[model samples]
Target chain A: MIVIENVSLSHRDTPILRDIDLSLPRGGITALVGPNGAGKSSLFSLIARLQPLQKGRITVDDMPVDTTPSRTLAQRLAILRQDGAVANRLTVREIVGFGRFPHHRGRPAAEDLALVDAALSEFDLHSLADRFIDTLSGGQRQRAIVAMTFCQGTDYLLLDEPLNNLDMFHARQLMRCLRTIADERQRTAIIVLHDINQAASYADRIVALRDGRVIADGTPDDVLTEDHLESIFGYRMKVEHMNGKPFVLHHL
Target chain B: MPDRRMIVLAAIALIAVLLFLTVGLRGNVQFVLQLRALKLLALLQVAISIAVSTVLFQTVTANRILTPSIMGLDALYLFGQTALIFALGGFGYASLDAGTKFGAEVLLMIALAGALLWPLIRTRMDMNLMLLMGVTLGLLFRSLSQLLSRLLDPNAFAIVQTASFANFNMLRADLTILGTIITLAAVVVSWRARHVLDIVGLGREAAIGLGVSWIRTAAGLLLLVAILVAVSTALVGPVVFFGLLVAALAERVMRTQRHALLLPAAALIAIIILVGGQTLLQHGLGGASTLGVVIEFVGGLVFLALLFHESRK
Candidate 1:
């Protein structure tokens, strides 16, 4: 379980996240949905320790976020940001191998190599394993990054809008992959998703944020109500249920 | 599939050994050989220090076109020298021991680098801001040095001009020894931090995520860079773009990001460029011109090529 208490983040006097308190239980996919400037990325940044905690406490699986060593945090949780900028000219396999750095430092053993190969196969990146990351397409690069994060073998994976720049096919494919990982591997994933339907379809739970606060949080069936959507998005939207799953119709 | 790095390292070692041998073979002129050896040592020290420092700086900054010289260490050295001359006339400045001047210059350069880097290290300023501050400080120091130079007599001005050219022929033995020691120390420290440097090249956030103490690593690398720049600039004055040229070329040739490979590759390339260029100047050009001018010209071209290549890609 991930516990965030009174997490308020301000960057240079501008409040990015205001008193965001939430508890995410272990297992399954929890899709964080929000409009632009809803502090979704900021929250992820704080959770991942990409940004320091200013006025709050967070714990992952009973380990305190601030007090725990970074290596310990890295082993417990892995984060994939939206913009994955790599400075070096690294191959896909080598990048995935970097996930094992906290575990092995620089010297990689046989088990590390096996894990890297397993991650590459898990993401269907076996063929592109030897190729340079810079040469891969947007969707392929996204998958490679996801594979690298997964290779860390962390219990909780935080993906900040992993669907960005991905086509419809790749997007669905990635969601399916995440769903499988969560279900079979028992990894808890907190993914920030822009597409409402994608969230409604695959997410076990949806937490909506607006104006730096959580406006709604519940199972998809409960959170996808027209009234809740209207309050959270500040716009009227129709919600339809097909095969017991809610689908939001927001396009005018 | 050639191991160009190994070839280059071998070539540099060969040239350095030949130079060492040539100095030894001049049996009758012990004083000349000793002087020549000192100059060669100074050159080697400058080459290795600048090459290694620039490569590390580029890796941290994530830009191929920048060198530690861009952070105004050269200007600071000049300013320190000019300030000395201004305070205590030409004769007093010239009469001062070479070791004293070298020590003063290095101290000033390290202080300047610390001042310029402190804010960036303390806070989370963007790279552009840091670059801007460095360039601004360089400009300010250059203007101050120019002002002081203009105030001096023609004889004093002449002394300043000679001091600014980055020539190794006049290097003092004591200064060279001191520089050698300092450069080796910096290199040893940097060698220990090599693995962390690989993570640092991944940029700030990712490096932090990888359990790298970003601030400490950056500060340590910057200090190493400062020490190197100080030692090299004291030895060879300042060849601003030479480090950039060698580091960029090394990266292109090696096609790898590992610092273990990149650092040595850069150092070897730097030694080759300087030693080879000096040899060409000595033999082909008949020792008519300065090596700094030639290096700066080539380095400028390489910098432009890198920028254009990056943009096109």
Candidate 2:
């Protein structure tokens, strides 16, 4: 389980995340849903150790995020931030191969190569393996980066807005892939998403944030209520039950 | 792959060896050959140090256009030398042991690099801020050096001028040995940190995500790069943009992000440029033009081309 206790983060004297306490169990998709300036990315950054902890304590699988060695923490949790820009001119395979760096360092054994190859095939990137990352399309590059993160084989995967720049078809496909990875691999995925329907359809649990605080947290069915949606999003949205799942009608 | 690198390396080696033999032998004088060899060694040292250091610096910065000199290392070196000369007149400066002077210069350079770059690495300052600070510090040092030189006697000022210009022929043998040691140490340090460098080139956040201690790695690499620049500058003055040229050329040729390949490739390219250029200057150009002037001219053109290419792309 991942535990965040009394987490409060401020940037340059402006509060970004306030006194947040939450526990996330292993083995399912938890979609972090919020509007702009909701501290979703900031929370992810703190959790992933991209930024130092400020007035908070977080533990992943009983290991303190701040005190644990980075290599050890890396082996347990992997994060994919939105718009991950790698400036180097690396090929797809090479970039994906970096996922295994913690395990093998620079000297990659055959097992490492096998894992990298598997990730490439899983993401449908085998054909583009030799192509440089800058040459890949937006959706393809997103998939490639996701594949690299997944290849890390961490139990808890934190994806901050994985659906950015993705079209409807690719976005859905990525969500389905994540769902399969969570279900089949029994890994926990905390995905920060903007599209409400995607969260409703794919995430087993939906955690809603507003003004740097968690306003609602429960099963998707419970969190998708019109009242909760209105309070969280500050807009009236019709919630329809279709195929035993709440479908939010907010496209208008 | 090793075979291919070997083949390219062997070709360059063959050319260097041939140049080494012919340049000294063609003169047909025993003393002249020895002098030519010393000059060649000095040129080779400067080239290798700048090339290797620049590539390492760019890798840490994740910038193709930056070199170690961009951080004002050359200006610091000049300032240190001018300060020494100013405090101790020309007679005293000339009387001082060459080894002591070399050690003092290197020590001062390292201290300056640490003072200027350590904070950036430790605090994770923005790249723009680091560059701005480096440029500003460099300008300050240059102005200080000029001011000091202005107060010196004309004879002392002339000595300082000779010391500041990039000249291989005037290189002290002890300085060459000291430079070689520092350059090797920098190479080893960089080699040990090669894996981290590969991750660092992925930009800041990805490196952190990959569990790299960005601060430590950046600090270590920056220091190493500073030492390298110091060695080159102390030995033959500053060759601005030389590292950028070699690193850019290496990237284009090797087409690899792996520093294991990139570092050696850049080093080899530096050797080729230095040795080849020196050979040509001595034989083809008959030493009429200075190697530093030619290299800076080419390096400047390459720098502009890179900026244009990046902007266009």
Candidate 3:
């Protein structure tokens, strides 16, 4: 379980996140949905310790995020930021291989290589594994990056907008892959998503944020109501039920 | 694959050394050989120091076009020497202990580099800002050194000029031994941290996400770069852009990002260039030109080409 209490962050004297308190349980998918400038990414950065904690405390499975050693935290949690750019001229396979660094620290045993192979196939990137990242298409590159993050073999995966640059088919495929990983591997994934219906269909719980505060947190049925989304997204959206799932008409 | 290339490069460097040492032995064999040996040692120290330091600096900065020399270290070195001559006079400066002089120059370079580089690294701002600041600082130091040079007496200026130029003929055995020791230590530490350096080349957030202590690693590598630039500048008076040439050539030749391979590859290339260029200058050119001038010409062209290539991309 991940626990957050009174976590507030300000950049250059302007508050980005404020007085947030929440506990995410183990072994399920949680989607963080919000409008633009809603501070979802900042919250993920704080949890990943990319940005130093300015106020309050967060613990991952009873281990404090701030106090734990980096290697220890890395083994338990992995994060993929949206703005990550690969400037090293590395091949897809080589980039994915770096995910095992915490486990092997440059001396990769056979098992690490096997895990890398598994990640490559898991993301349907086996054919493009040898291509350089710069040469790959945006959707292909996004899949490759996700493959690298998944190769870390962490229990908790926090991905901030992993669907960018992906086509609808690839995005759905990736969401399904994440769902499978969560259910089969017993790992928890907290993904920041913009698509409302995708989150409604896939996430076990949806956490809606507005102005750096959680305004709604519950199952999709409870949080995907037209009233709740209008309050969070600042617009009227038609929420209809299909096969016992809420489908949002926010595209218009 | 890189192993085979490394062997070929090592072989080439060995042949260069042989040709350099035995190509033309004249009047007194023993006396000439000893002098050439000292010069060879100095060349090796400078080559290793510059190549290793530049590669590491580029790794930490995540830039292929940067070197420790870019941060005004070599300019500061000249300023320090010019200041020493201006204060002590030519004769008094000559009388100072070589070890003391080398020690003082190295300390000053390290201090100045630290002051200029650490704050930027800590804040993690736009890297272009850091590069701009480095170039600006270098210009300032060069201007200051030029001003100092203008004020000195002709004779005093000559003394400083000889020390400032990249000349291998004035090798001192005591300073060579000291440099060899310091360069060897820095190389060993750099080799030990080779893997961390590879991870760092991935950028700061990626490195930190991979569990690397970003501040500690950057600080440690920065100090190592300062030490290396200090050693090479003290020994060779700064062969500007030569490190960029070697590193760029090594990356093209090795085709690998692993520092374990890149370090040796760059070192070997530096040795080949220095020793081979010296041989060509001495024998082929009949001492018509200096190796430093030739290197600066080639390195500058390569730097421009790299800038052009990157901009187009």
Top lDDT: which candidate number? 3
TM-score result, candidate 1? 0.92
Question: Candidate 2, B261: how far from true, in Å?
Answer: 1.7
True contacts kept of each: 0.43, 0.60, 0.42
State each model's CA lDDT, in order.
0.82, 0.83, 0.87
As a whole number from 0 to 100, the lDDT of residue A190 in candidate 1 is: 97
Scoring the B chain of model 3 against the true B chain gives a TM-score of: 0.89
lDDT of 2 by residue, A1-252 (tens): 999999999989999999999999999999999889999988898888888898989999999887788889888898898998885578899899999988888888999999999999887889999998888898888888888898888999999989887778778878898899889989999999999899999999999999899999999999999999999989999999999999999886
Flag clash pairs in model 3: none
Residue-level lDDT of model 1, residues A5-67, one tens digit each, is: 999988788888899999998899999998899999999988887777899899998887777
For candidate 1, write residues B1-313 as lDDT tens digits.
2276668676866675466436325556777677666767777788889888988898788777888877888888888778888888888987888776777778888988888778877775566787788899899999999999999998888888877877877777777888899999998887777777777887777776766666667777888999998888877787655786888777776777777777888887777667766666666677888888767776567668867886797
lDDT tens per residue, model 3, B1-313: 7799999999999998989899978889999899999999989988998899999999988888877877888888888888889999999988988778788888888888778667766775555676677789889988998999999999999988888778898778989988999999999999999887777888877777887867777878888988988887877787756888999888866777778899999999899889988988898888888788877665567657866876797
Off by over 4 Å in 2: B1-6, B24-33, B121-124, B152-154, B298-313
Find the 10 residues in a row with the least total lDDT in model 1 chain B.
B17-26
Candidate 1 regions exceeding 4 Å error are A11-13, A62-64, B2-4, B16-33, B125-127, B297-313
| TM-score (C-alpha, index-matched) for candidate 2 | 0.93
Could you give the candidate ranking by lDDT, starting with the highest? 3, 2, 1
What TM-score would every model get versus the actual structure? Answer: 0.92, 0.93, 0.93
lDDT of 2 by residue, B53-106 (tens): 887788778788877776888888888778888998888887888777777777
